[model samples]
Target: MFKLSSTVSQAPISINDSSPAAQASTRLIGFGQTCPQQGCGGASTTLKQLDTRINPDNMCSAGFNASTELCVYSTTSQTACYGDNWQRVGTCARR
Candidate 1:
C-alpha cells in the first residue's frame, strides 16, 4: 500500500452563491488515466487501470491494470497504470 500526500491543504469549495447546506455537501472529485505495462506489446491490446473516488476530496490517479486495483487508505495508495479503453473494473470506499 502507498501513502498519498496532498499538495494543497484545503478543499477547494465554491461557497459564494451556494447555500450553506450545498456548500457543506459539495465535495471535490477528479479522474485520470494510467500508462500501459512494459513488455505487454502493442498499444491496441494494452489495458490501463483507472481509479475513482480514491480520496475523500475525490482525486484520481492515472490508469492501471485491473489486477493492480487495490484498496488504498491514503494519497500514497494512488498509482498510474497503462491500458487501452477506460472502464470501471471495481469500486472502493474512503478509509
Candidate 2:
C-alpha cells in the first residue's frame, strides 16, 4: 500500500462569452486513469509535459487540460515514467 498527496491551488472559474454553459461545462476535465486503491487518484498533465522535449508521448488518459493547454493522463501509475507527477511522458494505448 502507498499514500500520495499534494497541495494544489486551483484557479478561479471564469465566465466566458464564447460559447454556451453546457458546452463549456463539458470541457472542465480532470483526472487520468483512476484506481480503486487508496491514494491513487492524483493524475494530471501539464504544458511542460506536453512539450516533446519533456515527454514524447504527450497524451492523456482522460482528455485535455484547456486552462494549461496541457495534455492530462498521458502517463500511468506504478511505472518507470510515472509516479506522483503522472505526466504525459508515458503512453495510454487504447484499441
Candidate 3:
C-alpha cells in the first residue's frame, strides 16, 4: 500500500534579484501533489506570467521568447508545469 501527502509553504520566495533588468509580473496558480497512483510525493509550487512582449525595454517588437518552467517530481519522477509558461523551481518535500 502507498499514501501521499502534500503541503505548501505560506512564505514567499524571491526570484531574480540583483539584476538591473525590469521585473516581470508573476502570479501563483496553486500547489499540490500528483495522484497517489502516480507515486508522486512532495509539495510543489506553480507560477504563471505573460510571455515576453514588446515594450520600451526591448523596443516595439515581440523579440522576447516565451518560456515554460517545469519541476521534476521527487518520488514519481514526473514532470509538472507550474502554470502555463511558468516553470517550477523547487519542491517542498516532506520526509
Candidate 4:
C-alpha cells in the first residue's frame, strides 16, 4: 500500500495556493488531522477508504500527482496516498 506525504513542512509555493472554501472544509474534518499553518485547504476523503488527506509531494513512481490534493488512485485498492500523513503518494521508488 502506498502512503501519502505532505509538503506542509516545506514552505508553500505561494500564500494563495490554498483556497478559502478548501480551508473551511478542512476545519469541518476536525481533530482527524493537523492543519498546516494555514489550515487544511486541500484536504479530502472518499468512500473508497479512510479520511486520508491530499499529499502535495508526489515523489513516487506510482504516476500520481499529489499537487491535485486528492486521494489519487484511492478509488481502487492501489491507494494513492498524499498529504497530512507525510507518506509518499505512490508506491514508486523514490530517489
Q: Which candidate has the highest TM-score of all?
A: 4
What are the Cα lDDT values of the candidates? 0.33, 0.32, 0.32, 0.31
* Candidate 2 colliding pairs, count: 5
Which tens-of-lDDT digit does each residue in 15-95 have in candidate 1? 343122211322222222233354445443434343323332223355633344333332235444332221232333222
lDDT of 1 at 23: 18
Expressed as tens digits, the lDDT of each residue in 1-95 for candidate 3 is 75548765655555542222334332323454443333455444543222231123333224332232211122233333322222333222221
Report residue 13 deviation for candidate 3 (angstroms): 2.3
Candidate 3: residue pairs that collide: 69-87
Tens digits of per-residue lDDT, candidate 4, 1-95, equal: 75558545675333344433321222111112223333334445432233333323443347555554333222223322234231232222111
For candidate 2, write residues 1-95 as lDDT tens digits.
Answer: 85549755975455443322221112222334344444555554532122122222234444544344323232323321223222122232221
- State the weakest 10-residue window (summed lDDT) of model 2: 19-28
Best candidate (score: lDDT) = 1
- Model 4 global lDDT (CA atoms, 0 to 1): 0.31
- Candidate 2 vs candidate 4: the TM-score winner is 4
Lowest lDDT sum, 10 consecutive residues, model 1, at 18-27
Clashing residue pairs found in predicted model 2 = 59-74, 60-72, 60-73, 60-74, 61-73
Residue 59 of model 4: what lDDT? 31
